[model samples]
Target: MAAAERRASPRRVRTALVALLAAFAVLLTGVSAEAQQRPRTVLEMLFGGGQQAAPERPAVRKPVVRKKKVRATRPARQKKQRTQAARPKPSGQQSAAAAVAAPASKNENAKTVLVAGDFLAASLADGLSNLYADNEMIVIEARTDGSSGLVREDHYDWTEKLGPILDEAKPAVLVMMLGSNDRQPMTVGSRSLASRSEEWVRNYEERIGEITEATKSRGVPLVWVGMPPFKFDRMSEDMVFLNDLYRKGASSVSGEYVDIWDGFVDADGAFVYSGPGVNGQTTQLRNSDGITMTNAGEDKLAFFAERAINRLLGTTLAATGALILGPDQLPTIQLPPIGNAANALQAAPVSIDDPSLDGPDMLLGTGSAGGFSLEPSPRERLVINGGGTGGTEGRADNFAWSEKSAAVTPSGPPIVSRGSLNLQSVRESGGLKPPEEMPTILDAIIEDWSRENEAARPE
Candidate 1:
């Protein structure tokens, strides 16, 4: 029995040890779980004393894919085919070229208009060219030296060269726009004369005469275009002086002078950059420099010259650029012969003073029908003779106090006099009763007060 007891005790001791080990294992597992959940301190981590928690991995989002929009593109082969189809055909190209060259070719036989002078004349020629571009009957011949002037004979002698130019061009009209560059000194032989001096003026006038003589000798009409006002006040003043000279020179040779001053000036006569254009709309006419003109300005500058040319040439240019010849050049029309000229009625000429123009030989009141009456007409007697229109016996105008007896008809009732039936007699006979008199203000007020009293007395 003792040995069995001893063996049972050993088994009991082993069970107790196994239970303690299980409890210790459970506690260690709980501590490890807590350590994992709680974050470690800096000291604990540095000392490596406590178990450090592993960092939780961040949630990874799925990548979102977008669909790409596809475009319909033509193939290179189709694009090339379309481009080739768009190309102009050979016939079309030829027609366009012909159309472009038509104006230049048509002007080959056009009458030349010789434009001669300095830089302004060159610009004038350009303007005139544009003006007559569509008119095939006229051609502008620019014989201008941009740097040439009457003062600078050494640079270009216009007087010496103008004669040859006129001969060469054989211009229908000579358009001269000079003196823009003539403000400089003039060289008369060995002396350099100041501009606008007596000697310079004489020399300038002589040069002008030379140009005019060339045109006069050639029998070409002259049209001298005056310079426009510049931005510079001094320059504009100089232009005015030059224009006066131009006017006299042109008039000396029976040339026409075109005054373009009012065209480029404001209401106050100052220079302007923008103004009423050819079409009358406000547009920029002068360039920024104010010495030169814009495209529109050039066209307007030509407008004055155009009128002179039209008058000198005796030709009217239509809006469509057609040239209408003068009356002398018009075709004569012959009328066809009548079927019977001998049977045509012939009217004799009548004199206005014969007094038979209105089919009356004598006045209506005159007794004679064939001869003129020596007696005056009633109107003439009233106006010239101070006569009165004697009133008729039965008329309303008769003011005689004596009452006339009614005229008796042979088979009818007695005729009543018109004067007895006048408005005064009718009123006396009570034919038209007079209007009743209106109540006075006092009576109206009294009547209103009586009505008020009656109302107050109570109905």
Candidate 2:
């Protein structure tokens, strides 16, 4: 009975301890809630003994003033996503950037002049390099490939070659000359076109456009040097046609077309083998074959383009009045040709009509003693062969011919000699006979020829 009493007493003590702990915990929780709900003043915190003050009225918690909930809009999310995407470049674009990375120019202080084309262009470059040898600002880069032309892609492909050159050199100006060798047939894919054919010309022009585009893409100015005349007339004609194409192509790109043909030709427009050199001294300018120029000729060729290049480069002479040409372009002016001491230029008089002023007969007609004639020469008459009895095989037709009155016909019309007949009186008056009463011109030619033959016999 004592043991049972002991167990009940211990159980009662444990219950009382648990009840006390529960009351203390409830008090601590209430204090914590009150402290958090209301801020304390310094005096209250010091004197209030950490006890929560009772409110005058039952306190109602102010509505929690939380920031207004912001709902994310679809457009804003989309915009955020786009900004993030733009911050990072796509993988494909990164690969492209790697592939197309360009090479920088090696020399910036020196203005690079890219001279490229066939043999002629090489010669031009040589001359220009020599010309600018002392020039500190210019650097001539010669990239000529002889035997290369627009037609023969197998030899060299300029379109493919130019990009790398442009990237590496970054030339300020591009000078070229190529058509001298491109006058042959061109084969495009499976088809073939004859030289200078309509189709060939189109293809050639397109190739030129490609070159111009490649140059202009890099912001380089182009100068296309035209081909000089060839020794053969037919080849010269072809060169003229080619020059037309070059001019058109150059003009399309706002490029300069240098016409060096006149510099290489004579006053009569014939290909000259000898001409004034860089020093104005007469020198052999062309090779024996007449196709290529000599050193002197090449320098002369550059003279034609020097002024233009100087303008483009903004080059000017120093305070001294001098030429931009090699050292000085002004040649020593020589006195006029004088045949004899009496005919010296200093002694010669400037008369209104000086007989000494020699020129072609077209400029100086024969003296008034001989009657001048404006009649059509026998050579100008067209010889038309027909059944005629004028002792001639063909009938000449400068005037009308009639077979009805062949026997009694006079020469078609009187051959009016100029300066001797009044044309107005002749046209108005009945000076011109009818075609029926006029003989064919064939008889007149026959008589003239026979008379000339007689005059020449034993004379």
Candidate 3:
């Protein structure tokens, strides 16, 4: 029975192989029909024949559709360029000029001074104008905003406004002073900071730097006038800090910083409302508000700034106008003639015979016992007088001196005249000496005392 089953399995396998061959022939016929309807590549056929065949008509390149380039006309381009160039560049100075009106006619040779800043700057302008009023070569152009500061950007911005004025005025020198109205909170975009805060100081300095850079870019010198002391102590203190920022900012850009703080302060650094005027009399420099300056105060402020301006301009124009008349053009001095003035000498030798130097003709002591003589005596003698009552009051002492004789010795007693008084007590006391020696009065007195003592000794 097992052998019969194996023979039956072989016949079954042959029947299964014939059925599989029939199915494969049916799939080939279906693919050939689809290929004949539409073209297909080897890659498309391998990829399940989803993609269409590439169109082949000698591989046409679509005629290379090159666009004809339209070049601009040289004349038109030049005209457009000229129009653009003709329009003034909106520079800092130009914008500043547009914001602030300036004079139309100005001297080309004159030195233009742009006095710029806040309220303080207005006074500075006035002072500078008056200072250079006599000088035809200096033209003061004032560009000031009273209600402006670096803090208030909404009202006025110095960094944005200065460029235009600088452009139109073309100042040879810039005199600037601000920060008076800046002692408050500053708002930059959404951020707000109090004055003197770290952020605000940094921002303030940046604005000053921008202004400084703009001025220096034109190769023009700048003079930054420092804020003066205010009437209030706190206000003055804030000004000090602001002035420091100005000094550093101006100095960093090779500009001059004119310190005017001390000019408005006392020795103790306190703010003074009424101080010494420029003429040395006490005058009000600041108003009752203690912020703005008076006319005299403005003059003083300009006095500080003028020093820096004069240095830049050299003041040569002022010197050129000074009139220096020669001696020929001056009036001659007329002096009156003095009596014997031409013969008079500043110094002269002493003259013994001059009548002006002669002694009086009348002699002294003439009415007395003896007359006084101007002439010197021929004989020389030392006169002494004892208290004798007979002599005249005008008589001098009668002590006579004699020249030495060959027979007389220098050590011998002096010879006495018969009329001379003899001190008898001296002779009795063994104090008497031979003629030719002079006796002192003390010796005579001692001898007289000795004689008295000897006599009184119980004899």
Candidate 4:
């Protein structure tokens, strides 16, 4: 019974100790949590803390008030001033704008060069404009449709439009470049004709003739720029054919035809993407598509047409800014009247081989000239007179036979020559000794037999 009671007492004490530990842990947790909730004061941080601390008061709240919106009396003026101050200076922009606008400004009597047809014509106009940008008397007016061509008259008929454009623009010159987009089948009244067919070519040529006639009737100078070779072989072939037609049409109307084929082709007459440009530098002339031209190509195209335009307009006008004088206006050049025919200086006809033809009475080394006697040179003596020193006796070149006997005396030295040394002379003079004769086959055999006999005879 005592053991049971002892055990129960220990258990009871253990229970009481556990309860005290739990209660102490709860109290510590509560104090730590409360300390965390409230911020440390300056005094607490500087010194130490106690259980009875001062409580934290609630933050004061301010009253909410609304302010009325104030409107400016001169808002527009203020805004304008603000905008003016904020705006950036357009110095560079203004200069760039002026540069662009400067090219467009021209004299009131500037001659208009009307460029008509397709996109190629438009590019041509751009090039011409750039070329004549400095010349105030020239202007390039482009009336082109990018997709228009002679084949599709319904879309844009150059035949009908050219007359009106000529009258309206009153152009000094009419430049046309088309047929690039005309490779497709062309439509006739009710029947569609295949591209490049005999019938189609006839019809196409007729349209070209019509445009040519219109320009001729209007009294405006016409310039038809032929198409350049394309990357495609078939397209290039068609262009060649079309260029021929253009040439014929232009010639019929007395229009100038500018052939730009050689410019865009290689040595073998194939299309080239890159070629010698206007300045003769190798550059990319055609675009990647090969159908369209790059800026350099456009300039090159203009270069060909520029010549024809200059010729028609009179080169003096383009080159020196001088007026083209007509036949009547040209100053007559009256050459001085020739003196009496008898007193006139005349030249006599001389033979081609005559040495006197060079202004001298005789050859250079022939004889005296102007009181100076010139001796004949060695070359002149040999070639002209066949005169030179004869070969020495006993020399290789000396072919003359000697009358002396063939037998030579052993005591006397052989004859010595000046040009070359002979073998006999060399030996006789003691300068060289005669070589010992080599043993013949019979002699060698006999010697060998004699040696064998001697050995056999007991040596």
Which lDDT values do the candidates have, in the order given?
0.79, 0.74, 0.75, 0.79
Q: Is candidate 1 or candidate 3 better by TM-score?
A: 1
Backbone-clash count (model 3): 21
Clashing pairs in 4: none
Per-residue lDDT tens digits of candidate 1, residues 147-232? 88889988999999999988888999999987778878887778889989998898898989998998999899999999999999
Between candidates 2 and 4, which one is better according to lDDT?
A: 4
- Report lDDT (Cα) of residue 294, candidate 2: 73
In model 1, which regions exceed 4 Å deviation? 1-104, 107-109, 325-459
Q: If scored against the real structure, what TM-score would every candidate get? A: 0.51, 0.46, 0.47, 0.51
Per-residue lDDT of candidate 2, residues 212-331 (tens digit): 899888888888889988788888899999899889988888988999888888899998889878788989888878888777777777777676566665566411213355535446
Candidate 3 wrongly placed segments (more than 4 Å) = 1-108, 316-459
The list of candidate 4 runs beyond 4 A from truth reads 1-101, 317-459
| Model 1, residue pairs in steric clash | none
Q: How far is candidate 1 from the true structure (C-alpha RMSD, Å)?
A: 25.1
What is the lDDT, from 0 to 100, of the residue 407 in candidate 3? Answer: 62
Compared with the true structure, model 1 gives a TM-score of: 0.51
